[model samples]
Target: MAEFSNSNTVIVAAGENLPLTETAVKAPACIVHREGSGLVTLRGLTSGQCRARFKVSFGGNIAIPTGGTVGPISVALAVGGEPLTSATAIVTPAAVENYFNVFVAAFIEVPRGCCVTVAVKNTSTQAVSIANSNLIVERVA
Candidate 1:
């Protein structure tokens, strides 16, 4: 099995997409992705290997806005614009500007030739900041 991975140390604003700009020095040909992109396309999958185990891992420091009373964050893996079932990760912050270490990881099964993405949703009523974040994707046979 070939594995392709990328990451970016950047902030994902509220209700905005994330682009993993840092491509790996060594990349696999089967997985195609553009630099500074948020989508990963799978290629060259046969019936025997139609299903791939997709692993998404990410972490960031976050801070809630002043007078915020809502919950933390929800992270998940989505394929073809639909979130996977039972693949969501949640993190809750207890204090203000506490440098919370929020890490979310999901392992999902995807068919061949599908586009995968990492999604972060804010559950709080106030705006939250996610900084110094990175996302990594891996394929498992």
Candidate 2:
């Protein structure tokens, strides 16, 4: 695995303000998963310190961490988009006004013709939004 910094520069919706209840960080269509056996990692950040909630869905079996980091870490799992399991992570403190990273790491085991997806929820009562993030997929045999 390559080492990476948990820095994020998100371009949130223009008209929206901070302290959002929950927002979706829509991924590019090209980044979707395909049938295979490997690991998929999603990394992102919030504008401020908040609790991040994540969900991962796979047609087969996948193992993921239940807890994440404020700057960058992996998300947990969910059936579709709703969290099948819950996890929490903190972001940069509100005073700093810095973007915090969120990540979802999974070791996927697929039978055949299966797929996976990752989604996130800003669990902070103060409302949070994502601007931009990156997805890294590593194949392991």
Name the best candidate (by TM-score).
1
After superposition, candidate 2 runs with Cα above 4 Å error: 1-79, 84-88, 102-104
Write model 2 residue lDDT over 1-141, tens digit each, in one string.
221111233222222221112113333322243222123333322234232222333211111112322332222332234343433344453332344445555443332334444333333333334433333333332
Candidate 1: tens digits of C-alpha lDDT, residues 1-141: 222233323444454445556654434654666766666655434467767675666666566545555467554455555554455456676765545666666775666765444444443345565566665666666
Instruction: Write down the worst ten-residue block by lDDT for model 1.
Output: 1-10
Compute the lDDT of residue 128 as modeled in candidate 1. 62
Spell out the clash pairs found in candidate 1.
Answer: none
Would you list the C-alpha lDDT of every candidate in the order shown? 0.55, 0.31
Off by over 4 Å in 1: 1-11, 24-26, 65-71, 83-85, 94-96, 118-126
- How close to the true structure is residue 50 of candidate 1, measured as C-alpha lDDT? 65
Clash number for candidate 2: 11
Model 1: what TM-score? 0.63
TM-score of 2: 0.36
